[model samples]
Target: MNAKPRISILFVCLGNICRSPLAEGVFRSVVTEHGRAADFMIGSAGTGAWHVGNPPDPRSIDIARRFGVDISHQRARQVEAADFNRYDLLLGMDRNNVQTLRQRAAGGTLGKIHLFLDYANDRVIDIPDPYYGGEDGFASVYQMIREASEALLSKFD
Candidate 1:
Protein backbone atom coordinates (compact mmCIF):
# COMPACT_ATOMS: atom_id res chain seq x y z
CA MET A 1 0.00 0.00 0.00
CA ASN A 2 1.12 3.55 -0.62
CA ALA A 3 2.16 5.32 2.51
CA LYS A 4 -0.91 7.10 3.81
CA PRO A 5 -0.89 10.87 3.60
CA ARG A 6 -0.29 12.60 6.91
CA ILE A 7 -3.66 14.31 6.73
CA SER A 8 -5.58 15.81 9.59
CA ILE A 9 -9.28 16.75 9.28
CA LEU A 10 -11.36 18.78 11.67
CA PHE A 11 -15.15 18.66 11.48
CA VAL A 12 -17.02 21.69 12.78
CA CYS A 13 -20.61 22.54 13.65
CA LEU A 14 -22.41 25.08 15.80
CA GLY A 15 -22.41 22.87 18.86
CA ASN A 16 -19.94 20.04 19.14
CA ILE A 17 -22.59 17.94 20.90
CA CYS A 18 -24.29 16.87 17.72
CA ARG A 19 -23.09 17.08 14.15
CA SER A 20 -19.34 17.50 14.56
CA PRO A 21 -18.86 14.58 16.93
CA LEU A 22 -20.92 12.36 14.69
CA ALA A 23 -18.78 13.40 11.74
CA GLU A 24 -15.60 12.60 13.63
CA GLY A 25 -16.94 9.20 14.67
CA VAL A 26 -18.24 8.33 11.23
CA PHE A 27 -15.06 9.45 9.44
CA ARG A 28 -12.84 7.62 11.88
CA SER A 29 -14.84 4.45 11.38
CA VAL A 30 -14.44 4.75 7.61
CA VAL A 31 -10.65 5.06 7.84
CA THR A 32 -10.48 2.22 10.36
CA GLU A 33 -12.58 -0.05 8.17
CA HIS A 34 -10.08 0.51 5.37
CA GLY A 35 -7.16 -0.18 7.76
CA ARG A 36 -5.90 3.36 7.30
CA ALA A 37 -6.44 4.51 10.85
CA ALA A 38 -2.84 5.62 11.18
CA ASP A 39 -2.98 7.52 7.91
CA PHE A 40 -5.06 10.39 9.28
CA MET A 41 -5.85 12.24 12.44
CA ILE A 42 -9.54 13.10 12.86
CA GLY A 43 -11.05 15.45 15.38
CA SER A 44 -14.09 17.74 15.82
CA ALA A 45 -15.14 20.97 17.51
CA GLY A 46 -17.96 23.49 17.64
CA THR A 47 -17.75 27.08 16.49
CA GLY A 48 -19.47 27.99 19.74
CA ALA A 49 -18.24 27.28 23.24
CA TRP A 50 -21.64 26.41 24.71
CA HIS A 51 -21.09 22.68 25.00
CA VAL A 52 -17.43 22.58 25.89
CA GLY A 53 -16.38 19.40 27.72
CA ASN A 54 -19.81 17.85 27.27
CA PRO A 55 -20.43 14.53 25.61
CA PRO A 56 -22.38 14.39 22.39
CA ASP A 57 -26.14 14.67 22.74
CA PRO A 58 -27.85 11.48 23.89
CA ARG A 59 -29.78 11.45 20.62
CA SER A 60 -26.54 11.56 18.67
CA ILE A 61 -24.98 8.75 20.68
CA ASP A 62 -28.04 6.57 20.37
CA ILE A 63 -28.32 7.04 16.65
CA ALA A 64 -24.60 6.50 16.06
CA ARG A 65 -24.66 3.39 18.23
CA ARG A 66 -27.51 1.98 16.17
CA PHE A 67 -25.33 2.44 13.10
CA GLY A 68 -22.41 0.60 14.79
CA VAL A 69 -20.32 3.71 15.41
CA ASP A 70 -19.71 4.66 19.02
CA ILE A 71 -19.49 8.43 19.60
CA SER A 72 -20.04 8.39 23.33
CA HIS A 73 -16.48 9.07 24.38
CA GLN A 74 -16.13 12.20 22.31
CA ARG A 75 -16.49 15.44 24.22
CA ALA A 76 -17.59 18.76 22.81
CA ARG A 77 -15.07 21.59 22.56
CA GLN A 78 -14.80 24.99 20.95
CA VAL A 79 -12.55 25.46 17.96
CA GLU A 80 -9.23 27.08 18.74
CA ALA A 81 -6.92 29.16 16.58
CA ALA A 82 -4.30 26.44 16.75
CA ASP A 83 -6.65 24.01 15.00
CA PHE A 84 -6.27 26.01 11.79
CA ASN A 85 -2.63 24.95 11.92
CA ARG A 86 -3.21 21.44 13.20
CA TYR A 87 -5.58 20.20 10.50
CA ASP A 88 -5.07 19.87 6.79
CA LEU A 89 -8.78 20.25 6.17
CA LEU A 90 -11.19 22.20 8.31
CA LEU A 91 -14.61 21.25 7.10
CA GLY A 92 -17.84 22.82 8.30
CA MET A 93 -21.25 21.23 8.47
CA ASP A 94 -22.86 24.12 6.59
CA ARG A 95 -22.40 27.63 5.24
CA ASN A 96 -23.14 29.35 8.53
CA ASN A 97 -20.52 27.26 10.20
CA VAL A 98 -18.18 28.23 7.43
CA GLN A 99 -18.54 31.84 8.49
CA THR A 100 -17.64 30.89 12.06
CA LEU A 101 -14.63 28.92 10.87
CA ARG A 102 -13.36 31.75 8.74
CA GLN A 103 -13.23 34.03 11.75
CA ARG A 104 -10.90 31.71 13.60
CA ALA A 105 -9.01 30.52 10.53
CA ALA A 106 -6.42 33.28 10.65
CA GLY A 107 -3.29 33.48 8.50
CA GLY A 108 -3.50 31.37 5.35
CA THR A 109 -5.74 28.61 6.73
CA LEU A 110 -8.76 29.95 4.86
CA GLY A 111 -7.73 27.75 1.97
CA LYS A 112 -8.35 24.69 4.12
CA ILE A 113 -11.80 25.78 5.25
CA HIS A 114 -14.57 24.16 3.24
CA LEU A 115 -18.11 22.97 3.36
CA PHE A 116 -18.24 19.25 4.08
CA LEU A 117 -20.51 18.69 1.11
CA ASP A 118 -18.08 20.39 -1.22
CA TYR A 119 -16.04 17.23 -1.40
CA ALA A 120 -19.01 15.14 -2.50
CA ASN A 121 -19.84 17.52 -5.36
CA ASP A 122 -22.92 16.18 -7.19
CA ARG A 123 -22.87 12.84 -5.38
CA VAL A 124 -23.99 12.05 -1.83
CA ILE A 125 -23.53 15.33 0.05
CA ASP A 126 -24.33 18.03 2.62
CA ILE A 127 -23.53 17.17 6.23
CA PRO A 128 -26.72 18.35 7.96
CA ASP A 129 -27.22 19.44 11.52
CA PRO A 130 -29.63 17.00 13.17
CA TYR A 131 -30.17 18.99 16.33
CA TYR A 132 -33.80 20.00 15.77
CA GLY A 133 -35.46 16.82 14.54
CA GLY A 134 -36.07 13.10 15.04
CA GLU A 135 -34.06 9.90 14.77
CA ASP A 136 -34.40 9.98 11.01
CA GLY A 137 -32.62 13.33 10.98
CA PHE A 138 -29.60 11.89 12.71
CA ALA A 139 -29.55 8.93 10.36
CA SER A 140 -29.70 11.25 7.36
CA VAL A 141 -26.84 13.31 8.69
CA TYR A 142 -24.75 10.20 9.28
CA GLN A 143 -25.37 8.87 5.79
CA MET A 144 -24.34 12.15 4.19
CA ILE A 145 -21.13 12.39 6.18
CA ARG A 146 -20.27 8.75 5.50
CA GLU A 147 -20.70 9.13 1.76
CA ALA A 148 -18.75 12.37 1.66
CA SER A 149 -15.98 10.87 3.73
CA GLU A 150 -15.77 7.99 1.30
CA ALA A 151 -15.51 10.36 -1.65
CA LEU A 152 -12.86 12.34 0.19
CA LEU A 153 -10.81 9.27 1.10
CA SER A 154 -10.78 8.13 -2.49
CA LYS A 155 -9.17 11.40 -3.52
CA PHE A 156 -6.50 11.17 -0.82
CA ASP A 157 -5.73 7.53 -1.51
Candidate 2:
Protein backbone atom coordinates (compact mmCIF):
# COMPACT_ATOMS: atom_id res chain seq x y z
CA MET A 1 0.00 0.00 0.00
CA ASN A 2 1.22 3.46 -0.84
CA ALA A 3 0.40 6.82 0.69
CA LYS A 4 -0.97 9.29 -1.79
CA PRO A 5 0.88 12.53 -2.35
CA ARG A 6 -0.76 15.57 -0.81
CA ILE A 7 -2.12 18.24 -3.13
CA SER A 8 -0.80 21.62 -1.98
CA ILE A 9 -2.98 24.62 -2.77
CA LEU A 10 -2.66 28.31 -1.99
CA PHE A 11 -5.60 30.66 -2.44
CA VAL A 12 -4.63 34.26 -3.20
CA CYS A 13 -6.39 37.64 -3.35
CA LEU A 14 -5.77 41.36 -3.10
CA GLY A 15 -5.91 42.06 0.63
CA ASN A 16 -6.66 38.50 1.85
CA ILE A 17 -9.33 39.86 4.16
CA CYS A 18 -12.38 38.98 2.12
CA ARG A 19 -12.16 36.59 -0.79
CA SER A 20 -9.10 34.40 -0.30
CA PRO A 21 -9.69 33.60 3.34
CA LEU A 22 -13.22 32.54 2.51
CA ALA A 23 -11.89 30.40 -0.30
CA GLU A 24 -9.33 28.73 1.97
CA GLY A 25 -11.93 27.99 4.61
CA VAL A 26 -14.50 26.83 2.09
CA PHE A 27 -12.02 24.46 0.48
CA ARG A 28 -11.01 23.14 3.87
CA SER A 29 -14.65 22.47 4.70
CA VAL A 30 -15.23 20.75 1.39
CA VAL A 31 -12.18 18.53 1.80
CA THR A 32 -13.01 17.67 5.40
CA GLU A 33 -16.61 16.87 4.53
CA HIS A 34 -15.36 14.41 1.94
CA GLY A 35 -12.86 12.88 4.40
CA ARG A 36 -9.95 14.01 2.29
CA ALA A 37 -8.41 16.59 4.57
CA ALA A 38 -5.18 14.67 5.08
CA ASP A 39 -4.62 14.41 1.38
CA PHE A 40 -3.96 18.07 0.84
CA MET A 41 -2.19 21.22 2.06
CA ILE A 42 -4.30 24.40 2.01
CA GLY A 43 -3.58 28.09 2.65
CA SER A 44 -4.49 31.65 1.64
CA ALA A 45 -2.52 34.84 0.96
CA GLY A 46 -2.81 38.43 -0.20
CA THR A 47 -1.06 40.08 -3.12
CA GLY A 48 -0.59 43.24 -1.07
CA ALA A 49 0.90 43.60 2.41
CA TRP A 50 -1.65 46.01 3.85
CA HIS A 51 -3.56 43.24 5.56
CA VAL A 52 -0.63 41.11 6.61
CA GLY A 53 -0.81 39.94 10.22
CA ASN A 54 -4.47 40.91 10.39
CA PRO A 55 -7.39 38.57 10.78
CA PRO A 56 -9.81 38.09 7.96
CA ASP A 57 -12.47 40.75 7.56
CA PRO A 58 -15.28 40.46 10.08
CA ARG A 59 -17.83 40.02 7.33
CA SER A 60 -15.88 37.05 6.00
CA ILE A 61 -15.73 35.51 9.44
CA ASP A 62 -19.46 35.95 9.96
CA ILE A 63 -20.35 34.51 6.59
CA ALA A 64 -18.18 31.42 7.10
CA ARG A 65 -19.58 30.93 10.57
CA ARG A 66 -23.06 31.16 9.12
CA PHE A 67 -22.10 28.24 6.90
CA GLY A 68 -20.61 26.26 9.84
CA VAL A 69 -17.01 27.02 8.95
CA ASP A 70 -14.93 29.30 11.14
CA ILE A 71 -12.52 31.61 9.38
CA SER A 72 -11.87 33.94 12.28
CA HIS A 73 -8.54 32.34 13.09
CA GLN A 74 -7.03 32.67 9.67
CA ARG A 75 -4.50 35.48 9.45
CA ALA A 76 -3.62 37.49 6.41
CA ARG A 77 -0.14 37.18 4.85
CA GLN A 78 1.45 38.59 1.75
CA VAL A 79 2.26 36.16 -1.03
CA GLU A 80 5.96 35.38 -0.86
CA ALA A 81 8.29 34.60 -3.72
CA ALA A 82 8.86 31.15 -2.29
CA ASP A 83 5.14 30.45 -2.64
CA PHE A 84 5.44 30.28 -6.41
CA ASN A 85 7.33 27.01 -6.10
CA ARG A 86 5.99 25.81 -2.78
CA TYR A 87 2.44 24.88 -3.73
CA ASP A 88 1.17 22.60 -6.44
CA LEU A 89 -1.48 25.14 -7.34
CA LEU A 90 -1.83 28.85 -6.62
CA LEU A 91 -5.46 29.84 -7.18
CA GLY A 92 -6.32 33.49 -7.66
CA MET A 93 -9.75 34.85 -6.81
CA ASP A 94 -9.91 37.26 -9.74
CA ARG A 95 -8.17 38.26 -12.95
CA ASN A 96 -5.88 40.75 -11.26
CA ASN A 97 -4.83 38.24 -8.67
CA VAL A 98 -4.14 35.63 -11.30
CA GLN A 99 -2.22 38.09 -13.41
CA THR A 100 -0.11 39.08 -10.45
CA LEU A 101 0.66 35.50 -9.62
CA ARG A 102 1.55 34.78 -13.20
CA GLN A 103 3.82 37.75 -13.37
CA ARG A 104 5.62 36.74 -10.20
CA ALA A 105 5.84 33.07 -11.02
CA ALA A 106 9.09 31.85 -12.47
CA GLY A 107 8.93 30.40 -15.95
CA GLY A 108 8.95 26.82 -14.69
CA THR A 109 6.05 27.42 -12.28
CA LEU A 110 3.74 29.26 -14.62
CA GLY A 111 1.46 26.30 -15.27
CA LYS A 112 0.58 25.95 -11.58
CA ILE A 113 -1.10 29.34 -11.34
CA HIS A 114 -4.74 29.73 -12.43
CA LEU A 115 -8.07 31.42 -11.91
CA PHE A 116 -9.78 29.73 -8.98
CA LEU A 117 -13.20 29.56 -10.64
CA ASP A 118 -11.81 27.46 -13.43
CA TYR A 119 -12.75 24.47 -11.33
CA ALA A 120 -16.40 25.53 -11.14
CA ASN A 121 -18.94 23.75 -13.33
CA ASP A 122 -20.12 26.92 -14.98
CA ARG A 123 -18.26 29.45 -17.05
CA VAL A 124 -14.93 30.77 -15.83
CA ILE A 125 -15.37 33.89 -13.68
CA ASP A 126 -13.80 35.97 -10.97
CA ILE A 127 -15.09 35.79 -7.43
CA PRO A 128 -16.04 39.37 -6.61
CA ASP A 129 -14.42 41.15 -3.68
CA PRO A 130 -17.02 41.94 -1.02
CA TYR A 131 -15.04 44.39 1.10
CA TYR A 132 -16.87 47.46 -0.18
CA GLY A 133 -20.27 45.83 -0.35
CA GLY A 134 -22.88 44.82 2.17
CA GLU A 135 -23.32 41.49 3.92
CA ASP A 136 -25.38 40.31 0.98
CA GLY A 137 -22.27 40.37 -1.19
CA PHE A 138 -20.43 38.19 1.28
CA ALA A 139 -23.20 35.62 1.15
CA SER A 140 -23.18 35.57 -2.62
CA VAL A 141 -19.42 35.16 -2.74
CA TYR A 142 -19.60 32.35 -0.20
CA GLN A 143 -22.00 30.39 -2.37
CA MET A 144 -19.77 30.90 -5.37
CA ILE A 145 -16.60 29.85 -3.51
CA ARG A 146 -18.32 26.82 -2.02
CA GLU A 147 -19.33 25.62 -5.47
CA ALA A 148 -15.84 26.07 -6.82
CA SER A 149 -14.30 24.53 -3.72
CA GLU A 150 -16.32 21.35 -4.09
CA ALA A 151 -15.42 21.15 -7.74
CA LEU A 152 -11.74 21.69 -7.00
CA LEU A 153 -11.67 18.93 -4.40
CA SER A 154 -13.32 16.52 -6.79
CA LYS A 155 -10.80 17.29 -9.47
CA PHE A 156 -7.93 16.51 -7.12
CA ASP A 157 -9.49 13.68 -5.15
Candidate 3:
Protein backbone atom coordinates (compact mmCIF):
# COMPACT_ATOMS: atom_id res chain seq x y z
CA MET A 1 0.00 0.00 0.00
CA ASN A 2 1.15 3.52 -0.72
CA ALA A 3 1.56 6.11 2.00
CA LYS A 4 -0.28 9.40 1.76
CA PRO A 5 1.67 12.40 0.55
CA ARG A 6 2.45 15.01 3.17
CA ILE A 7 1.43 18.59 2.52
CA SER A 8 4.35 21.00 2.89
CA ILE A 9 3.81 24.54 4.21
CA LEU A 10 6.20 27.47 4.67
CA PHE A 11 5.31 30.58 6.67
CA VAL A 12 7.07 33.85 5.71
CA CYS A 13 7.62 37.35 7.06
CA LEU A 14 10.04 40.28 6.83
CA GLY A 15 12.44 38.53 9.20
CA ASN A 16 12.19 34.87 10.09
CA ILE A 17 12.91 35.60 13.76
CA CYS A 18 9.49 37.00 14.48
CA ARG A 19 6.05 36.37 13.02
CA SER A 20 6.89 33.52 10.67
CA PRO A 21 8.54 31.42 13.31
CA LEU A 22 5.60 31.95 15.63
CA ALA A 23 3.24 30.99 12.87
CA GLU A 24 5.29 27.87 12.22
CA GLY A 25 5.30 26.96 15.87
CA VAL A 26 1.59 27.64 16.36
CA PHE A 27 0.63 25.66 13.30
CA ARG A 28 2.83 22.79 14.36
CA SER A 29 1.24 22.78 17.78
CA VAL A 30 -2.26 22.80 16.33
CA VAL A 31 -1.52 19.94 13.95
CA THR A 32 0.15 17.90 16.62
CA GLU A 33 -2.73 18.49 19.00
CA HIS A 34 -5.13 17.15 16.40
CA GLY A 35 -2.95 14.15 15.63
CA ARG A 36 -2.32 15.36 12.08
CA ALA A 37 1.32 16.25 12.54
CA ALA A 38 2.62 13.38 10.48
CA ASP A 39 0.32 14.34 7.60
CA PHE A 40 2.09 17.64 7.05
CA MET A 41 5.55 19.17 6.73
CA ILE A 42 5.87 22.66 8.24
CA GLY A 43 8.60 25.30 8.13
CA SER A 44 9.20 29.07 7.95
CA ALA A 45 11.41 31.73 6.30
CA GLY A 46 11.79 35.44 5.72
CA THR A 47 11.81 37.72 2.70
CA GLY A 48 15.02 39.38 3.88
CA ALA A 49 18.48 37.94 4.60
CA TRP A 50 19.28 39.94 7.72
CA HIS A 51 18.48 37.29 10.30
CA VAL A 52 19.68 34.27 8.40
CA GLY A 53 21.32 31.58 10.59
CA ASN A 54 19.86 32.96 13.82
CA PRO A 55 17.17 31.44 15.99
CA PRO A 56 13.73 32.99 16.43
CA ASP A 57 13.77 36.22 18.40
CA PRO A 58 13.85 35.85 22.18
CA ARG A 59 10.51 37.65 22.40
CA SER A 60 8.89 35.30 19.94
CA ILE A 61 10.29 32.26 21.68
CA ASP A 62 9.05 33.49 25.03
CA ILE A 63 5.58 34.28 23.71
CA ALA A 64 5.27 30.86 22.14
CA ARG A 65 6.42 29.21 25.33
CA ARG A 66 3.65 30.99 27.23
CA PHE A 67 1.20 29.26 24.95
CA GLY A 68 2.81 25.86 25.54
CA VAL A 69 4.61 25.83 22.18
CA ASP A 70 8.37 25.95 21.85
CA ILE A 71 9.69 27.86 18.85
CA SER A 72 13.20 28.30 20.17
CA HIS A 73 14.58 25.68 17.82
CA GLN A 74 13.44 27.43 14.65
CA ARG A 75 16.14 29.35 12.79
CA ALA A 76 15.92 32.32 10.49
CA ARG A 77 16.15 31.71 6.75
CA GLN A 78 15.63 33.78 3.63
CA VAL A 79 13.01 32.67 1.21
CA GLU A 80 14.62 31.03 -1.82
CA ALA A 81 13.52 30.39 -5.39
CA ALA A 82 13.70 26.66 -4.71
CA ASP A 83 11.22 27.02 -1.84
CA PHE A 84 8.37 27.60 -4.29
CA ASN A 85 8.84 24.10 -5.58
CA ARG A 86 9.50 22.60 -2.18
CA TYR A 87 6.43 23.80 -0.32
CA ASP A 88 2.84 23.23 -1.31
CA LEU A 89 1.80 26.43 0.44
CA LEU A 90 3.87 29.59 1.08
CA LEU A 91 2.07 31.90 3.52
CA GLY A 92 3.24 35.48 3.94
CA MET A 93 2.66 37.38 7.18
CA ASP A 94 1.80 40.65 5.49
CA ARG A 95 1.46 42.50 2.19
CA ASN A 96 5.13 43.38 1.76
CA ASN A 97 6.27 39.83 2.31
CA VAL A 98 3.70 38.57 -0.18
CA GLN A 99 4.83 41.13 -2.74
CA THR A 100 8.46 40.13 -2.29
CA LEU A 101 7.60 36.48 -2.80
CA ARG A 102 5.53 37.28 -5.86
CA GLN A 103 8.37 39.22 -7.39
CA ARG A 104 10.74 36.33 -6.84
CA ALA A 105 8.38 33.64 -8.04
CA ALA A 106 8.67 32.30 -11.56
CA GLY A 107 5.56 31.58 -13.63
CA GLY A 108 2.89 29.48 -11.93
CA THR A 109 4.80 29.27 -8.70
CA LEU A 110 3.23 32.57 -7.70
CA GLY A 111 -0.14 30.90 -7.31
CA LYS A 112 0.94 28.93 -4.28
CA ILE A 113 1.88 32.04 -2.31
CA HIS A 114 -0.74 33.80 -0.15
CA LEU A 115 -1.23 35.92 2.95
CA PHE A 116 -1.14 33.86 6.16
CA LEU A 117 -4.40 35.44 7.25
CA ASP A 118 -6.06 34.52 3.99
CA TYR A 119 -7.00 31.23 5.54
CA ALA A 120 -8.57 32.93 8.53
CA ASN A 121 -12.33 33.20 8.64
CA ASP A 122 -12.18 36.51 10.42
CA ARG A 123 -11.65 40.00 9.03
CA VAL A 124 -7.95 40.17 9.90
CA ILE A 125 -6.09 40.76 6.66
CA ASP A 126 -2.51 40.90 7.82
CA ILE A 127 -0.33 39.65 10.64
CA PRO A 128 1.38 42.76 12.00
CA ASP A 129 5.16 42.89 12.46
CA PRO A 130 5.94 42.96 16.16
CA TYR A 131 9.71 43.34 15.92
CA TYR A 132 10.02 46.86 17.32
CA GLY A 133 7.25 46.56 19.83
CA GLY A 134 7.31 45.42 23.44
CA GLU A 135 6.30 42.10 24.98
CA ASP A 136 2.59 42.83 24.59
CA GLY A 137 3.09 43.01 20.85
CA PHE A 138 4.46 39.50 20.81
CA ALA A 139 1.47 38.35 22.79
CA SER A 140 -0.92 39.88 20.28
CA VAL A 141 0.94 38.28 17.38
CA TYR A 142 0.75 34.89 19.06
CA GLN A 143 -3.03 35.20 19.44
CA MET A 144 -3.47 36.18 15.82
CA ILE A 145 -1.37 33.26 14.65
CA ARG A 146 -3.12 30.83 16.93
CA GLU A 147 -6.53 31.81 15.56
CA ALA A 148 -5.41 31.77 11.94
CA SER A 149 -3.62 28.47 12.35
CA GLU A 150 -6.81 26.88 13.60
CA ALA A 151 -8.80 28.27 10.69
CA LEU A 152 -6.14 27.22 8.19
CA LEU A 153 -6.07 23.68 9.53
CA SER A 154 -9.84 23.42 9.40
CA LYS A 155 -9.72 23.68 5.63
CA PHE A 156 -7.97 20.35 5.35
CA ASP A 157 -10.49 18.57 7.53
Candidate 4:
Protein backbone atom coordinates (compact mmCIF):
# COMPACT_ATOMS: atom_id res chain seq x y z
CA MET A 1 0.00 0.00 0.00
CA ASN A 2 1.22 3.47 -0.72
CA ALA A 3 1.63 5.79 2.24
CA LYS A 4 -0.04 9.18 2.32
CA PRO A 5 2.04 12.34 2.02
CA ARG A 6 2.43 14.39 5.18
CA ILE A 7 0.78 17.77 5.71
CA SER A 8 3.61 19.97 6.91
CA ILE A 9 2.71 23.14 8.80
CA LEU A 10 4.78 25.96 10.26
CA PHE A 11 3.34 28.46 12.74
CA VAL A 12 4.76 31.97 13.00
CA CYS A 13 4.45 35.06 15.21
CA LEU A 14 6.40 38.20 16.13
CA GLY A 15 8.26 36.25 18.80
CA ASN A 16 8.56 32.48 18.67
CA ILE A 17 8.13 32.21 22.43
CA CYS A 18 4.45 32.96 22.64
CA ARG A 19 1.61 32.40 20.14
CA SER A 20 3.45 30.42 17.52
CA PRO A 21 4.84 27.92 20.01
CA LEU A 22 1.43 27.40 21.53
CA ALA A 23 -0.05 26.90 18.07
CA GLU A 24 2.64 24.34 17.28
CA GLY A 25 2.05 22.42 20.49
CA VAL A 26 -1.70 22.57 20.31
CA PHE A 27 -1.73 21.47 16.69
CA ARG A 28 0.63 18.59 17.46
CA SER A 29 -1.58 17.50 20.31
CA VAL A 30 -4.61 17.74 18.09
CA VAL A 31 -3.04 15.63 15.36
CA THR A 32 -1.99 13.03 17.92
CA GLU A 33 -5.37 12.96 19.54
CA HIS A 34 -6.86 12.38 16.11
CA GLY A 35 -4.42 9.54 15.46
CA ARG A 36 -2.81 11.47 12.61
CA ALA A 37 0.55 12.25 14.15
CA ALA A 38 2.34 10.32 11.44
CA ASP A 39 0.50 12.28 8.79
CA PHE A 40 1.95 15.68 9.55
CA MET A 41 5.01 17.80 10.28
CA ILE A 42 4.45 20.69 12.68
CA GLY A 43 6.77 23.52 13.77
CA SER A 44 6.86 27.11 15.01
CA ALA A 45 9.07 30.13 14.26
CA GLY A 46 9.29 33.90 14.56
CA THR A 47 9.44 36.59 11.91
CA GLY A 48 11.92 38.46 14.09
CA ALA A 49 15.11 37.00 15.63
CA TRP A 50 14.98 38.50 19.10
CA HIS A 51 14.12 35.27 20.88
CA VAL A 52 16.07 32.77 18.84
CA GLY A 53 17.59 29.83 20.78
CA ASN A 54 15.06 30.31 23.59
CA PRO A 55 12.14 28.21 24.75
CA PRO A 56 8.49 29.21 24.81
CA ASP A 57 7.63 31.90 27.32
CA PRO A 58 7.00 30.70 30.89
CA ARG A 59 3.32 31.49 30.71
CA SER A 60 2.95 29.71 27.38
CA ILE A 61 4.67 26.67 28.80
CA ASP A 62 2.45 26.79 31.84
CA ILE A 63 -0.75 27.14 29.86
CA ALA A 64 0.10 24.25 27.55
CA ARG A 65 1.07 22.12 30.53
CA ARG A 66 -2.28 22.81 32.17
CA PHE A 67 -3.96 21.37 29.09
CA GLY A 68 -1.92 18.15 29.29
CA VAL A 69 0.50 19.18 26.55
CA ASP A 70 4.19 19.68 27.34
CA ILE A 71 5.77 22.35 25.14
CA SER A 72 8.83 23.00 27.28
CA HIS A 73 11.25 21.26 24.94
CA GLN A 74 10.42 23.33 21.88
CA ARG A 75 12.96 26.04 21.08
CA ALA A 76 12.44 29.42 19.49
CA ARG A 77 13.71 29.80 15.93
CA GLN A 78 13.61 32.49 13.25
CA VAL A 79 11.58 31.96 10.09
CA GLU A 80 14.01 31.40 7.27
CA ALA A 81 13.60 31.56 3.49
CA ALA A 82 13.99 27.80 3.23
CA ASP A 83 10.93 27.29 5.41
CA PHE A 84 8.66 28.44 2.58
CA ASN A 85 9.86 25.55 0.51
CA ARG A 86 9.87 22.95 3.28
CA TYR A 87 6.38 23.34 4.71
CA ASP A 88 3.05 22.85 3.00
CA LEU A 89 1.56 25.67 5.08
CA LEU A 90 3.10 28.65 6.86
CA LEU A 91 0.53 30.09 9.26
CA GLY A 92 0.96 33.34 11.14
CA MET A 93 -0.71 34.37 14.37
CA ASP A 94 -1.76 37.82 13.14
CA ARG A 95 -2.09 40.05 10.11
CA ASN A 96 1.41 41.48 10.46
CA ASN A 97 3.09 38.11 10.69
CA VAL A 98 1.06 36.82 7.75
CA GLN A 99 2.07 39.86 5.74
CA THR A 100 5.71 39.37 6.69
CA LEU A 101 5.64 35.74 5.63
CA ARG A 102 4.01 36.59 2.34
CA GLN A 103 6.57 39.29 1.68
CA ARG A 104 9.46 36.98 2.49
CA ALA A 105 8.09 34.08 0.47
CA ALA A 106 8.83 33.97 -3.22
CA GLY A 107 5.95 34.52 -5.65
CA GLY A 108 4.95 30.92 -6.17
CA THR A 109 5.09 30.16 -2.42
CA LEU A 110 2.55 32.84 -1.54
CA GLY A 111 -0.43 30.47 -1.49
CA LYS A 112 0.95 28.56 1.47
CA ILE A 113 1.13 31.47 3.94
CA HIS A 114 -1.90 32.69 5.88
CA LEU A 115 -3.17 33.94 9.23
CA PHE A 116 -3.45 31.05 11.71
CA LEU A 117 -6.96 31.89 12.87
CA ASP A 118 -8.31 32.08 9.32
CA TYR A 119 -9.09 28.39 9.59
CA ALA A 120 -11.21 28.82 12.70
CA ASN A 121 -12.20 32.45 13.12
CA ASP A 122 -12.57 34.32 9.88
CA ARG A 123 -13.79 37.41 11.73
CA VAL A 124 -10.94 37.67 14.23
CA ILE A 125 -8.09 36.47 12.04
CA ASP A 126 -5.51 36.26 14.77
CA ILE A 127 -4.32 34.52 17.90
CA PRO A 128 -3.31 37.49 20.02
CA ASP A 129 0.17 37.64 21.55
CA PRO A 130 0.08 36.94 25.25
CA TYR A 131 3.69 37.81 26.03
CA TYR A 132 2.82 41.20 27.47
CA GLY A 133 -0.43 40.24 29.16
CA GLY A 134 -1.42 38.52 32.38
CA GLU A 135 -2.41 34.88 32.97
CA ASP A 136 -5.87 35.21 31.51
CA GLY A 137 -4.44 36.24 28.20
CA PHE A 138 -2.45 33.04 27.83
CA ALA A 139 -5.50 31.01 28.69
CA SER A 140 -7.52 32.75 26.02
CA VAL A 141 -4.82 32.39 23.43
CA TYR A 142 -4.48 28.69 24.23
CA GLN A 143 -8.19 28.17 23.74
CA MET A 144 -8.11 30.00 20.44
CA ILE A 145 -5.17 28.00 19.16
CA ARG A 146 -6.78 24.73 20.24
CA GLU A 147 -9.99 25.46 18.39
CA ALA A 148 -8.15 26.52 15.28
CA SER A 149 -6.00 23.40 15.35
CA GLU A 150 -9.08 21.25 15.24
CA ALA A 151 -10.53 23.28 12.43
CA LEU A 152 -7.33 23.19 10.43
CA LEU A 153 -6.86 19.45 10.91
CA SER A 154 -10.32 18.92 9.51
CA LYS A 155 -9.05 20.05 6.13
CA PHE A 156 -6.39 17.36 5.95
CA ASP A 157 -7.79 14.45 7.94
lDDT of every model, 2 decimals: 0.87, 0.91, 0.90, 0.90
What is the per-residue lDDT of model 3 for residues 76-129, given as tens digits with 9 covering 90 to 100?
A: 999988999999999999989989999999888988988889745545488889
How many clashes does each candidate structure show, in the order listed?
A: 0, 0, 0, 0
**Residue lDDT tens for model 1, 42-139:** 99999999999999999999988988999999999999989999899998888889888987778698999988888545442456678889988988
Off by over 4 Å in 1: 1-5, 122-126
Whole-model lDDT, candidate 4?
A: 0.90
State candidate 4's TM-score.
0.95
For candidate 4, the C-alpha RMSD (Å) to the true structure equals 1.5
Local error of candidate 2 at residue 3 (angstroms):
6.8
Choose 2 or 4, whichever is better by lDDT: 2
Off by over 4 Å in 2: 1-5
Which regions of candidate 3 fall more than 4 Å away from where they truly are? 1-5, 122-124
Sorted on lDDT, best first, the list reads 2, 3, 4, 1
1-157: candidate 2 lDDT, tens digit per residue: 2275488899999999999999999989999899888888899999999989999999999999999999999999999999988899999999899999988889999999989997455557899999999999999999999989888887874
lDDT of 1 at 58: 96
lDDT of 3 at 25: 93
Worst 10 residues of 1 by lDDT: 119-128
TM-score of 1: 0.92
